[model samples]
Target: MANVAISELDKNCGKVVAEIVKLERKIFPKHESLASFFENELKKKNSGLLYLHVDGELAGYVMYSWPSSLYASITKLAVKEQWRRQGHGEVLLKAAIEKCRTRKVSCIMLHVDPLRTPALNLYKKHGFQVDCLVESYYSSDRNAYRMYLDFDSS
Candidate 1:
């Protein structure tokens, strides 16, 4: 079995942050990427990042924030293309949810592209329900689903 581990990323860890930024640029479109603002996002007291490493290499990451005491938001979730479909995304997602649980949030929410079937399935498997369709959420031509996982129902 491969050596795998997940841990909270420290905002001051420049090397890891740089690596994540590089991966973000590769995985997401320019307008959707938070690569340029990652460091600043990490500096926020209510936000944090958790990363998964496979054989000591970065495999995936999830970014989450509890801006309000009542709820949390999963801002991003990404797995390296090489690591896709190997359960890395699920592991990272579960970790992020657990982190939000620790913060005593009632629910966790996220926005996802409706066309990304794998991602939609993954979130649905974890009990995220689509609350509404967000028209042009990503762009003029793209729509998104606003999904939420309520701890109270779980």
Candidate 2:
């Protein structure tokens, strides 16, 4: 638990990609194309990818996908295992929410593993509520819990 800073992730996209791969392997252990898609879209202004730096090192990352006319989707959010419970997740999440507010987006959504109780609780604490259950959503056939947060104009 050190000084943590989050900024738009670009130069660190590759590291973020690797961290996700690490998570994937720890869980169902499969490679997917979503990581590459996010990396490519980072060069565009309408899209954003957030990274966390703590104690002067890249500790975690998160991202929101803005595709033309869709509600910005939280594509990924991962903090290295050693850095968990240090509040970096909440920091990145608030950053993402603020990013949406700045863009005038009214709703933000994300998908989380239904079995990850801690993560589900974390999102709930931040005002994200379950929207739906995406059954067999991943290559590993793991269920995904879709969550949404509505931003108020006032």
Candidate 3:
């Protein structure tokens, strides 16, 4: 948490997407669409990404979307393998949640694969609850659980 600079996200934004592809071990966004998608979205929102850096190296990245909605959606979040279990994920999420709350967002939302136990647990520990399950949500070959956190809890 002490070694994070949200501004450095763009440097390794694409890498974070690649890392997610590796970590999830699922067929997703083989092309650079995911990475490029963030660029476009961020540009549209006039917002930026939040980056987590550890030991002077980029460790993770998260994309936040706040489109006149009450909830800020976490479009993506991923940490490098070596940086996991060090509380970086929590730190990144905290930063994002705070940012949204400061902007008057009522809540934060994110999605995780039901099969990803660790991710589900992490979200739960951070006050995110399974709001609902989206059938065939991810690429029609996978399902995703939408999680939400009320800003008042922060």
Candidate 4:
């Protein structure tokens, strides 16, 4: 397994953005707004894009936004097919969680497709709990589990 390096993306990240767009097409074929969405995120102070490079190659990325003081939302996360089980996703997720923690957010939340067992398992193993099921959350044909991790234990 190659060593993975995580980096915060910026406007000058054309090559990384291109790679992300390519992977987005493969991972979420129906989502055509990713390029623009990521670009906009690069310009937002409250939003972030983090990419993981394995052996100098783009392996995966995670995007998130701090919508409010109370919680941060994970907007998207994906690891290339070849890098799926090599701990890249967990690294990216942990990075995102740390980013949120720095902002003093009380909780971190994300929506995952119910059909994606591996992703669901990853989040669960990382201490996330399913908050509820949202029908047609992703689209009219897909449902989602709204999962959250609370930093404040009561």
Candidate 5:
């Protein structure tokens, strides 16, 4: 595995935005985050982005938001297909979790497609529990598990 570095994306970096869009399209062909929404998120004080770089390439990223003091929500997490199984996703996830802790959020929440077993297992390993089932959460054909990691407990 190549050494990976984590960096917070700067809102002013247009190049980073373009790279992110490209990666999103490849990783999430049907559910790509809109460029306008992504750009808007970059400008938000309560939102954050973490990028995992392997030898100067974008290996993965996590985008999250602290909409309120009570909870932090992970909007997206993706690792390049080539980077899967190398722990890049967890690295980005841990960084995002730490960022939430810094803001003193009570819990971190995320939704994952139920069919995505690998992702479900990853969240479970990180202390996230299924809070509920969100029917058609992602789209009409997809359902989701609403998982949460509470900071109040160990």
Candidate 6:
């Protein structure tokens, strides 16, 4: 069996951040990627990253931020192409939600491309409901669904 682990990314871990940046570039379009600003984002008190490793190799990560006590946003979730469809994304997502739960947040929100079926399914399976269709959320050609999981209602 593959050994799996999930842990919060430490701001001081430069090597890990670099690896994540490389992975981010591969997974997201340049205009939509937060890779260039990831380190800076991590430095913020309310922002953090959770990474999942399979057999000691980075498989996926989730970036989240809580700008206010009552709400949190999941800005990114990406699994390596080879690791896709293997439940790594779900694991990382669960970890991020748990982190928000521990902080007593009332709602967790995220935006996903409407056309990304696998991702939309994953979020829906975890109780995230579409609140609205965000036109041009990603780019001129791409639209997104603004989804949210309300802990108070669940």
The 10 consecutive residues of candidate 6 with the worst lDDT sum are 7-16
Q: Would you list the C-alpha lDDT of every candidate in the order shown?
A: 0.95, 0.73, 0.71, 0.88, 0.88, 0.93
- For model 1, how does the per-residue alpha-carbon lDDT over 37-83 read when each residue is reduced to its tens digit? 98989999999999989999999899999999999999999999999
Q: Write the per-residue lDDT of candidate 5 for residues 33-104, one digit (tens) a residue.
A: 555467877789999999888988988899999999999999899999998988888888889999989999
lDDT of 3 by residue, 1-154 (tens): 3555555345445765455345433323443236435445655553546776666676776667777667678877777777888888888877877777767888888888899898788889889989999988776778899999987775
TM-score of 3: 0.77
Q: Write the per-residue lDDT of candidate 4 for residues 1-154, one digit (tens) a residue.
A: 5676899997788988989988887888565347656566667789998999999999999999998999999988999999898789999999999998899999999999889999999999989999999998877888999999999961
- At residue 125, what lDDT does model 2 achieve? 92
Stretches of candidate 5 off by over 4 Å are none
> Which one wins on lDDT?
1
Worst 10 residues of 2 by lDDT: 27-36
Q: Number of clashing pairs, model 2?
A: 0
Q: What TM-score does prediction 1 earn?
A: 0.98
Q: How far is candidate 3 from the true structure (C-alpha RMSD, Å)?
A: 4.3
Q: Candidate 1 — worst ten consecutive residues by lDDT sum?
A: 7-16
List ranges where model 6 is wrong by over 4 Å: none
Candidate 6 residues 11-33, lDDT tens each? Answer: 57788889899999998989998
Q: Which candidate model has the greater TM-score, 4 or 6?
A: 6
Cα distance off (Å), candidate 3, residue 141: 2.5
Model 4 residue 6 CA deviation in Å? 1.0
What shift in Å separates residue 101 of candidate 1 from its native position after superposition? 0.6
Candidate 1, after superposition: displacement of residue 151 in Å? 0.9
